[model samples]
Target: MKYTDTELEKTLNELGKATYAGEVDVVDKVMNRLKEAENKEKFSIQKERKVRWTIGTMSLAAASVALLLFIGNSSSSQAQNENDGMAKFISEIYNRQSQADVVYYTPDYIDILLGIEGMDENI
Candidate 1:
């Protein structure tokens, strides 16, 4: 309902001044909530730092392991590739139809055979 300012003031005066109904520590409650929020924020920040450190450490370890595996496998594969190239070259040279007879044993091969037979030691 609409009322003039003077009528409103007269009504309020008849109602008397308002009084608080109960004991309420609003300031303490607000301060306690602030403290709890700050503590929660600090805890979350520390947890975030821990998670970052853990992820960083794990990533470094994974990279290190990958590097070691690559280096190790590369050296072994290089040796294998060299051996394969030499074998392919020898097969091409010695096992051809035009050069089958030229694939006969050499003196070094005969010596190795004699040593395997225990005859080179006697000689």
Candidate 2:
């Protein structure tokens, strides 16, 4: 299928003088196809960008929700810990109340209990 130099020169000279008068709309057809392909390419690129943006936004929202849930759980656990401590404190108060005969010693009673004889004279 290789052309000799003389054949190549003759083909080029013919192409230079040739006109598409018999196929009047060939140029328009080619241009229309090119335009359609360009539009499809542009739409494809735009659609791809939209998909990427949507995925990114959704991922950010999901991460934000996860972070909020984690913070809420930690705060709830801290509150539960405080509530447990408060319940223990309340139980201790009830136990103290139930010991009705528990005596509080003044300084003199402490000295008597400790067998210190000169505490009265010191007072």
Candidate 3:
């Protein structure tokens, strides 16, 4: 499209006058809308940050609890193993005590009692 220079000047002059008179209510409405959108964006960003922090804290707490439980179970198993070892040691000691220095006698005791020639003193 082509316009004469005169027509362009006239259109520019009218636009200038309208702007100077503050007759551009659409611009003001657009500015207000932009400000509101910026405020809402800021609020949403802050809300997202808070939610992320809460989730992070909860995850850390859960991890700590899990670690504690793992430690407790490991310690309990170790203690049980020690108790089992002690019980085995005690049983071995009891068995040794019961078998100490007991003499057996058969009809062979009569030969030793009479001091026979083939009697062995080792018994």
* Tens digits of per-residue lDDT for model 1, 13-59: 87787777998778988999999999999999999999999999999
Rank ordering of all candidates by TM-score, starting from the highest: 1, 3, 2
**Error in Å for residue 74 of model 1:** 2.6
The residue ranges of model 1 lying beyond 4 angstroms of the native Cα positions read 1-21, 96-123
Best by TM-score: 1
**Model 2 accuracy (lDDT, Cα):** 0.82
Question: How displaced is residue 69 in candidate 3, in Å?
Answer: 1.0
Candidate numbers sorted by lDDT from highest down: 2, 1, 3
> What's the residue-level lDDT of 31 in candidate 3?
92
TM-score of each: 0.58, 0.52, 0.56
lDDT of 2 at 72: 100
lDDT of candidate 2 over 3-102, digit per residue (tens): 9999999999999998867746589889999999999999999999999999999999999999999999999999999999878865765565465434
Worst 10 residues of 2 by lDDT: 101-110
